[model samples]
Target: MTTPNNTEHANIAVITGASSGLGEQFYETIAHRYPDLDEIWLIARRKERLEALAERYPNIRARVRALAFDLSAASSYDELSSMLAEEQPVVRVLINNAGFEREGLLRDMAPKDILAMIELNVMGMTMVNRVFLPYMRAGSFEVITGSVSSFAPIPWQTVYSASKAYTRFLARALHEEERKRGVNVLLMSPGNMNTEMNVQGTSTGKLGHLPYLDLKRETARTLMMAERGHATYTPMLFYKLYRLFAKLMPSALAVKVTSIENGDTHGR
Candidate 1:
């Protein structure tokens, strides 16, 4: 695979899961907003898709490096590290945007998909964050894609929501720790999006009509929030209130309510 040219001292943004969905949006956001960036490395399991995405940025595609590797696979981490060793790109932003969820009861969902949700969302994401921290420096930015479901128990999406809760808390704490070093971390917990992931998964009956925010709008909002150093950036006032309501409920009660409200979505 050919690496971007003159990458040794390039100001680069590393974005995972860039083959589609919100990951693609994040790629576009960075490319358009930071045209002066020396390079943007797009990582995903699909080389074809990554190539297609690169085509969209004709003016900068040559500077946009594409690496096809699955984030859920541990060996892929070694691949990334090796590339860093070879290219030594000066990383400016790291976007851990690769993750998935299934729409079904825990027992009914395919075991592999269920396990993959955990691996990619929680385990892999954490490891990715740690592996790259040493490369990040002051003025560097990071965004971890989370969800409103993180604020409460979301039945049917039980494991998915739980994983995001881990992301949300982890990002908040990481933000505090990395801030002293001048790195800004933002946990983007936006509501429903009209992306393939949400359209296919996210079995939230109560949130079926979740105000899917515009991709570009939310992307810009997220960056603005990060620039201002907001650690937990939840879009929409409605979700902010929803989070508060969930926090006010008893833990057991929240679970029970979640099961009753969204657990029945697989039927639809």
Candidate 2:
């Protein structure tokens, strides 16, 4: 296994989807709190945004790295691993936070968009964990962002919910496998938040109303808790309660509710 850098294992963090929202929040929070991180790698399709975020902190700016690539492609994992090997940073943390969803009836959804959802949300997430496992094993933490939707089937956002379900299961399985290796794996399931992903009009009408959502800052805190080896983290208290309620509803009924909740938005 590639060992972490000289810094303590508790600090370094690599976050995907770092150009926006919850991922950005995690990056900023850790950069401010963990000065010992030898390096922080921000991966996303948006290179310009990642660069801008890096510029904000002189210390992080010095050690921060960014990779702009479409992770939906399987080849991206190999390329990312190559880059990491070249840099040889002791990567103590890895965040699999990039994902997308399609909004519509399964039959009406664009074929390409559905494929893209699977590619990014499920395949890409698996690839990220696989490519980074060696580096992480040499470190202390790993976190995968799942969703509350993973608990039950979601109708209009069918494939997306399935994708998150895969991610959640993957995290749990990986955590069990890596416990002895000293790497802690956390699966973070946040209720809706105010992000472009859930914006009013762009796509995927899976946005939870503001009164019931957890902001990005709280999502970041939940991620931190998971980094400490918590099995799962639900950022919103109501979301946690909602999950409990969801468990009581029939799976079929729950799916209908989700379809209604997400009917208005389109795919990303």
Top lDDT model: 1
CA lDDT, every model vs. true structure: 0.79, 0.74
Clashing pairs in 2: 4-90, 5-90, 204-266
User: Using alpha carbons, what is the TM-score of model 2?
Assistant: 0.87
Q: Per-residue lDDT for 41-92 in model 2, tens only? A: 8888988998898787885533787778889987787787776666655557
Error of 2 at 65 (Å): 1.2
lDDT of 1 at 161: 86
Where does candidate 2 stray beyond 4 Å? 1-11, 59-62, 200-216, 266-268
Q: Please give the RMSD to the true structure for each candidate, in Å.
A: 4.1, 3.3
TM-scores of all models? 0.89, 0.87
**CA lDDT of 177 in candidate 1?**
96
Tens digits of per-residue lDDT, candidate 1, 1-268, equal 2233443476788888788888899898888888778888898888998988877878763388788887888888887777776766667888888887765677878898888888898888887787676677778889888988788887777888888899998998999999998999999987777665456345456666457778888888888788778888878888888788888998788877665344333210
Output the lDDT of residue 146, model 2.
Answer: 90
- Model 1, residue 254: C-alpha shift (Å): 2.4
